[model samples]
Target: MLITPDISTLSYKRQLAKRFDRASRSYDSYADFQKIVLDRLLAMLPLSQADVVLDLGTGTGQALGILSQQLKPKCNIALDLSPQMLTVARERFSALPNLHCVCADAERLPFQEKSCDLVFSSLAVQWCLSPLDLFNELFRVTKPGGYVVFSTLSQGSMPEISQAWVGLDSQRHVHDYMAQDALLDCIKASGLNLLSSQLSDILMWFDSPEAAIYSLKKVGASLIAGDAHSSVSPTRWKAFLREYEKQRDERGVPLSYQVSFIVAQRPAIV
Candidate 1:
């Protein structure tokens, strides 16, 4: 069944694609953090025998490689929205016969319904223009008794910078993540019966605010719906830095991220 997606839900994803497409040339340097997160996510998943796994937003094929080695799925479809990102993924996984890269939207997935045993998405779904619709699409493709595992930042993500920015200036650069309770509600509404979910408050320390912003851009995360080119005056930047510094911990400035991990199952009858 073809699903027509609402553009509002994919607005952030379009912005992030621009960010990632621009950063693809330099993404490898900062991808280690993503790898760590991927490892943590993988440890939580349990795969069935030769099960087909759909890796949504599989940037650079690293996630596919990891899944292939760990889950040994019979076939892996690595789908990403950015052509540049998929190019990187295709190059990296060229030798892996099991992995195939396709450029497609996550919300309106171009795959057979109820054909996949598992649908795994990482940091990607947070950027879904319409998370509810995306989850619904995920539920559509997953076979009965199949699993859906995903991770995304919560509302508290980047509080230090967001709070400071509001005080220093009215510019909002951080994207708004779904709240834990709200996100769970969306998942449930999509018909994926929740098995378990863990919402954790995580913080990432950075040497400087510029470094933090740079890392965000490097990871293709700078596009916060309306944040195009924030032309802040020097005075505003200074004020912003001062407010941001207030949120610093003993180690250094902290980027607050409330992360949620979910493991849900599609009903066997569905």
Candidate 2:
């Protein structure tokens, strides 16, 4: 079973939204890793046209241009939990008349059943309370024979941060990312036909430890599940920087992520 954090509360959800909303302006500039991962996820899609495509957790709508150009969908729906993020998306893609932006939760999508011909998300669903609930929502909104493609962080992501915080405090500074097996189990249990999945480590190098950590914060990914409101003291924060500096090698400071890419399809009714 996936031991997820207690992120189901309304207050926690609000905090999450606020964080992403505040980061909307800086997200695109600091989201180099996200851009790379989005390209990889897009490559997994088959060359085909669709009437409607849903971009779940479409933060800043980075993939909207590519999805519209490639799929040639009649309508593109960009959904996210942060209203500010959607505002940024709407302004950025104003030229695309077919594009629509909606602020909503991924676990409880606002779309009708069998409404979207394709659903695509990248580096987004892991923030949900439960992967099973998320996948079920995707299966529900996706039309028969339609596809769902997504990429999420897996276990053992950002080890450098955890390693640096080892002695400073044990208050769970890092997010408890789900294990690969647990994530696969959720997909299998969601009733979407498993097509193909891949697990790999995405390593990012930074000039300094502060820059590496700031990258996460600028993308609104710095919040831990249960400890979103806490702040680290300057002393402890400085100590953490020193410890992280010890991890430096020829490639400067390193931050790593274990990412899982998944592709599934809703079965057609006989």
What is the C-alpha local distance difference test score of candidate 1? 0.78
Q: Please provide TM-scores, in order, for all candidate models, with all chains considered together.
A: 0.90, 0.95
Against the true structure, candidate 2 reaches a TM-score of 0.95
Q: Mind giving the per-residue lDDT tens digits that candidate 2 earns over 105-157?
A: 89878789999999999998888886898889898999999999999999999
- CA lDDT of 220 in candidate 2? 92
Off by over 4 Å in 2: 1-8, 226-230
lDDT of 1 by residue, 73-117 (tens): 888898888889988888888888777777888878888999888
After aligning candidate 1 to the native by TM-score, how far in Å is the CA of 109 from where it should be? 0.4
Clashing pairs in 1: 9-129, 9-130, 10-129, 60-89
For model 1, the superposed segments whose C-alpha errors exceed 4 Å read 1-14, 226-231
Q: Best candidate, TM-score-wise?
A: 2
User: lDDT (0-100) at residue 253 of candidate 1?
Assistant: 78
Q: Which consecutive 10 residues in model 2 have the weakest lDDT in total? A: 223-232
